[model samples]
Target: MRPAPLNPLTRAASLRALARTSPATPLDVLVVGGGVTGAGIALDAASRGLSVGIVEAADWATGTSSRSSKLIHGGLRYLEMLDFPLVAEALKERDLLLTRIAPHLVKPVSFILPFENPLADRVYVGSGVTLYDVMSARVGQKRAVPTHRQLGAAQSQERFPGLAAPYGGIEYYDAQVDDARFTQALVRSAVGLGASAANYARVVDYLREDAPAADEAGAAGGGSDGARVTGARIRDEETGAEVSVHAHATILATGVWTGEQQAAADADTGLEVLASKGIHVTVPRDRIDAPARVGVITRTETSVLFIIPWGELWLIGTTDTPWREDVGLPLVTATDIDRVLEGANAVLERPLTREDVVGSFAGLRPLLQPVDGTGDSARVSREHAVLEVAPGLSAIAGGKFTTYRVMAADAVDFAVRSRFPRSRSRTEDLPLLGADGAQLSASRRSLVLANRDLRAHGWDEARLDRLLSRYGGRLADLFALIDAEPALACPLPGAEHCTAAEVVYAVRAEGALHLEDVLHRRLRLEFEVPDRGVAAAEVAARLVAPVLGWDEDRVAEEVARFTSVVDARLRAEAAETDAGAVEAVAAARPGGGQGRRVRRIARM
Candidate 1:
């Protein structure tokens, strides 16, 4: 059976559903993080016919999940590391997502692994890419992308003009997504399947049957009475209110906060995860002079660099290094920017400068640390570990964005398999909210013809195509919003690619609690633009204020708060050192506009 359409992720609906789970009458499963894994878990549990609730500390995908390299390919570098299982597993899931799960959110993208030394480099790299394809072919009923093809030096240069050396290249296929939006889609899909979810809801402490007080180390959830973990004492971060959400089983997919959760749960058993900071910088599409959709993948001394082609800009990234600083403040420094620029310049025909960079971001990967602590994050295992931290509590850590579904299932199997042994995960076959509509509309002409009303409002085929690509089947919802108010059919004030209806849909349908969530995650005006979306922040706030019931002062505060955050990121990006960058963004650490909680919510 096809999954139902999404439910509006309003705070009112989420809280009312959460209020149903009490100590006496607990829900089936409580997923304690709302990142990709947690959201995936909620959907996985719900699809398998279980009552589930997923809560996040901040907005969904505000962690590592949102800040990925935005690639959905098997780890080609892992093949070099001789870890075939990880690559194979990821390839299977990758195809599943591309074909069945999230066809709308994830799309096929091509990359050129350019060769400087055609002799040995071609053989070594070509062999690995061949293996990557074979693994994918063996995974599922249908292949998601085409196999790799080798090109000559001139041929490669003709295909990808940005190649520094025209010694030929291996053209391979992968998929890319708007990471934050993909995470949000996963959430809405889960909600459609009856998973109660809310952002800005933090779990303060675990709710257990019998537990002891803190020790010298301030340990929580410890007891001598054979205590079984029940649920959590959650604090609404938007409001100061607290709630007791009871559950039969609890799963923790908190990513980098795994260690802290271990101590919080007072569990002697679990995974030891380390934080690895990976940063990326984005420049205008014309900077490197690359082809329409073809990107370059070059090997760095430490890790591989991906020059991913996002909508209007080129995303160059990823430096993997040990990070021991605050996880929430994952800001990029001058050194990080310099490293990324240098890595890209090594492959690009034209070098990218600091001024060319429009925006940058950093995400902390939760890697399963080796016992000796090799200090090299690249050497650490990306494979996740799931174990019972307590009787009713289970935690999952490590793994990459590509394999979140497998991780979620593993975590669920550990937490609930023993209790409900017959229950199996059904998410692999479930299409996310927007996927059905995207598949139904084959091309731009079909979509434009279907929504002739958009043409009446001066919306062209390009605008309609963009909407379908972003919202998929959910595009109808936007059309409905535009029909309600013709003004909503217009584009956002500063961010021209986004429509005014998106802001309202973000508030009403998506769970965008603050200005930051809508701009940064929903519209992606934050990292995609040069001004870091500060230009559109005010207009966006104004558009969403009425739906959220914000007064003039509140709208001003939202705009001001988002502007301050943008300024802080700029200061951080300009700072000389990583430590200096951290200090620069000290003021922007997640919780500024919490004085007055949202009182009213727009009905679905």
Candidate 2:
């Protein structure tokens, strides 16, 4: 059978297409949230040959999905918590990503867990890593990641130049990915399979057979009156336009915003999603004495700290604290910054100070509170829960980035349990858009890549290799755009390691509506620059302005809008408390009409 054409997700085209469906011709599934989980659900449902549409209230992956540590791993710390099943599940997904799913996007990364007491700590950590390897091995006959190995003091320091621990470290394997890009790829792939997706489309209320939802009236169980959710009342943030999307079933993958949606819907999902804020700071790669191959992971008093190597920077972070303020508008406050730096400084020969910090971000984990709701955010379970929020509506919250596919499969399974009897998850061996071609044997891939004409673009073999790793089979898609507009191949003046082609691609293909979306999420200039992408914003904005259909005034408006957020975020980072930070960011965030995609399966 001929599959549907992969039409570009230009903002105008998507909005028009998404607004077409009505109650008479409803979709099979309507997914809320364009993060990793919802994206995975879109693909899962489409692969089952069900008609699906996914909507996001903001930009795709602009929430927790984009702000993660970018690790694809079996939580090593979760092992100490004795969550064997969770560790095992995440390990299985990690391998699937490395070997079968997104090898180009998700690659093997080794971490050095430094030990102060060589004897006791080594034995204890070694056993834990050994178990981690065993769990991984059980999932796959061919090992996708390397096993744990003991490193001597000399070897440890050789791998990571700065070693605060006198004793050696345990070298173990995990994986890392560009989480936002990966989530976008899932949406693109799903769209290729005929699923409908739109961003900047927020669900204002739920659609019921009895009556349309009236601003919650009773967000947990009122107005619903045992009625089934027929669909959702969606608001177009850009135009202040509203539309009703009719679907047989609705799945809410709203992450931390799950609570807000539940309250608004008057549906008791039983699953209580508590927002736990985590912060990460970035420093230039040279700022930390760590090598490219070896990242550092150490035990913090409250949580684990990782000094992971990102392109030209070291991403170190993650303070786990309970948050009571906003849902998606998390800020990296002064205290949060200090907590992460102090944690990383404890295991560094030369400590990092506030001056060395370049960029930082914060994410809210939709931590599932225990039935008793007794433990702190750090101790809460990472396992996900699928709840029957109401008849024809399902909600899911809590899960590791590594195990998003599992959560998606479970959510789809629950949502369609009685509705679609023959439909089953077919995403186990499914490769994302770029993975199939990317999985070519290295030697063959190298030989094939060698034939590309890159002289005009000033790209060498190494640069092309990076392109292959980042785009996989989608290299052709990017090149197609460049071919149409030769100037796009030029390097972006301010943004290092990125080309103007990316900005155009983000709009034409990746559904990026504004300059902020390109600079922050698509190009990642925000996390890579000391000025927080402010300097690069103009060039990127100009490049994407035409594609996004912006005039001089619109371009300037976009740049100013982006700058306001960056300026606000910078101010927020200096604030002492979350409240202060919230006040700072909220002041700049414009909402009269503001931000935010999904999709299908080829292999299934």
Candidate 3:
């Protein structure tokens, strides 16, 4: 069946809905967090005919969701830890995403793991990758991804010229995705399924009804200590409006902020989430001199580094180090960049330098603090745990991107059990917003459609292909924008890959309230471009201003804010020490760019 188009999320309507929540018509489930898992939970609950609402403090994917390694594969390293179940479950989810859930967003990519010890290492790594392929095939879904194969050193170098020569390697298949876009699509899909979702809406505190009088206390669930959580007090970040939303059950999927969310509910649960920082360095693909189609994966002393191929860049990452700083602002320091470069240089034929890096981003992984004294966050299990913090409040934390759907299902299963024990999760078979129209023959159909409608307005095969890949069946919306104004068909100056229509569409269709949402999440210009979308910020703000109802001054302010964020990131990345990077990044905080005086005044 063809899914219905999603409703547009605007500031006015979302705020109005928040103001109207009452005990009479309370939401069946109120989900906190707008990441992949929370969006999945909203979709899961809404598909089963439940009233669901999800709220995010910042723009969608502003946290770890946007700053991932972007792979949708089973962790091969987990297999060495004798964790077969985790690998098997992840493979099944990967298969579902590749074939059914989000085929347009998730595409398969080949990866080669180089080995120095020809005989023993090849036997070990080859056997591991074989098992990985076998587990994926066992999922019973369509094996759209191919199996593993052996590659000689010459073959590996021929496939990937940038790699340092090794004895041999094992080539295997896995899937990659635009993680931020997928998360937004999930939220949109949930909204389409009758779920209410809002970004830039922060939940400050839970609303627990006061204890009844002494006479009525006995009648009301035995005593005053038996009070249950009723709802939450949400603060709208844009307008600073506070509203109370009543819900039957509240689910917290805040990744790194799991502890904070629970504390807001006054729950004294021992759900410790240690924040482990991982940084990724983006370099222009040409500088790496590697194949555009293949990715390189190798083991570093700390963790594995993946050189994944993005559209115009190579994303080389990730150092797993313990982080004790503020989780809200994770800065990519010189040390972080140097660590990544060191890892990449170990495998590349040509060593990468600091100048080779075009962009860098850091994300925090919410690793579950172990009780048995496992110090390494990498060794910690990616399995998530759900805790019933109170009578009706549930919080889940510590899971990988591949198993988000499962985590959502489990969290929702726990949250809704008391109310609707019979309700089962239907998200496994439920496709995302644009999935139904994205068939195997979608490319041929889109080309024909684009030629018919968009040929007159500067759209060719290449432009239509890019739009079709991102929007799937929803390409009609972009076409409509172009039809109204042919100038909207023109692409951005610095980032020609994105059009003005996309920026407008982001504010009007997607829930983009700020310039960062458009540049960082919607268009991906922040990470792809060297200036981090500063060159295109003015154009984007101007294009989206009319749609977003921004005045001349407001447009200028937005552009300035975005530029400051870019400058702050660059300064932080250039800092020599972690402490120095943290200090530099503080300047980009809410009122920081304006100065310490503004921050003090704002706090007052």
Tens digits of per-residue lDDT for model 2, 1-604: 1122222344446556666777787888999999999999999998899889998887888888898999999988888989998898888899889988898899888999988897998889899999999888853288987788998888888878876757888999999999888998888878877788877788999988764454232233322245778889889767789888888879889888787787777774445888888899998888778768678898788877999988778999888998887575778899999999999889999989999998998888878865322211122235777776666677788887899999899888777766676778989878888886674566765565456454566665555666777788777777888778877777777765777777777787777776777888878777788887788888888887766667899888878877877887898898999999877766656664332111000000
lDDT value, candidate 3, whole model? 0.78
What are the runs in model 3 whose C-alpha is more than 4 Å off? 1-11, 139-141, 210-225, 370-382, 439-460, 587-604
Candidate 1: Cα lDDT at 306: 92
TM-score of each: 0.91, 0.90, 0.91
Task: Quote model 2's TM-score.
Answer: 0.90
Which 10 residues in a row give candidate 2 its minimum summed lDDT?
Answer: 595-604
Model 1 lDDT tens row, 1-604: 3333332335657767887788888989999887888988998898888889998877888888778898887888888789988888888888988988888888889999888787988898888888889888953366788999998988887887877766898999988888888888888888777778878788888887754343211232222234678898888876768888899888888888887787898876666888888999999887767676788898898878999988779998899998877766677899999999999888888888989988888888887854232111122235876666665677778787888888878777666765687888887888888887674444756666565566655566667667777899888787788778889987787888778999888887888878988988888776788887898988889988887889999899888777777787788888877788867766444563331221111000
Candidate 3 clashing pairs, residues 3+ apart or interchain: none
Give residue 580's lDDT in candidate 3 (0 to 100). 86
Q: Which has the better TM-score: candidate 1, or candidate 2?
A: 1
Which portions of model 1 miss their true places by more than 4 Å?
Answer: 1-9, 138-142, 211-225, 370-382, 439-458, 587-604
